[model samples]
Target: MQYFIQRHPLNYDGSQLQSLFTYKNFGLMGDSVLVFRGSCTVEQNEMVDMEDVVAQDWIHSEDMLHFIVEHFDMDLEKTIVRQRLLIATIKEELEVRGVTTLRRSGDDLYAGDKKLSVSIATLSPVSTLVHCGLNISNHNTPIPTIGLTNLNIDDVFQFGESVAEHYCAEVLSMRLARCKVRGVS
Candidate 1:
């Protein structure tokens, strides 16, 4: 259960609909540009700049999926394929760690007679958001469930860093392969 924040850049036009930044290296998925905008203090004076500021803030997995579908005009079939692929990868990873009882249904993974559940969502084509929850019961009486949010930021950050590193390396390899195939040196 790790999460990474991805920023997407938008350019404002006369209309409310903004344009997304695309990169050639991203292949069919396209790329998102990370832009950081904040107020800067100069001489003890804080000033706010007035710009179109076409940007989407840090969003959760579900929100990120919707944002991609809407902004990138992704078809439903492609979305479902991506979602299934991501869930399958997560299921395989969990199974490798001795969690063989896990069952995947749609975007959720359940284990131990519903005692544990992990909901997987895609933040983007390359990134996944996994939220784990544990069910607690007292003599057949169910109690409030505990979730991954209880974990500290340091733990989450460490996990996310590892995942990001792996993902970036895989993406870079794929891009390089494509470049070589295209005879682009």
Candidate 2:
């Protein structure tokens, strides 16, 4: 698994969660995760989660830290597991940074009652993809939102790097664990 932090700010519009997005856009081949600071406004047409669309829950934030994860294996269940893993990894990182009151409900993370992140996973022909976005600034959000700034996290880039590193390590470790296990006949 490869991890890359995108230095430039890019707007996430729900369309980047596709197969080869990291390879085509950032040149990171194979299973990879790309992190970046950005603005999020998922257009309806680009939305993947049917529940969100049916409920008319718009995904928008003025500023966010986005994690786009892509794996070559196309398994929706596994992809959802990876999505939750990333969320839990973020929660762990937050706790490490002294933010202990975080709560994770499914794929979303919350600081008390205010939402801290949004995420979704889906299949894209050749790959399973996930998009997780953390609020950086509590601005222009549709609902009550809490951001990294509110959590007293000043170094956004460093925080993002730590998250990417830990998530990649966990995923790689899991893969190793699978390989090292002997199947019972």
RMSD of each: 14.1, 0.9
For candidate 2, lDDT tens digit of each residue in 1-185?
Answer: 99999989999998788889999998999999999998999977998989889998889999999999999996899989999999999999999999999999999999778999989999888999999999999988999999999999898889989999999999999989999988898
Worst lDDT run of 10 residues, candidate 1, spans 58-67
Question: What lDDT would each prediction earn against the true structure?
Answer: 0.31, 0.92
Per-residue lDDT over 74-108 for candidate 1, one digit per residue giving the tens place of the 0 to 100 score: 35454355445444553554454444666777755
Winner by TM-score: 2
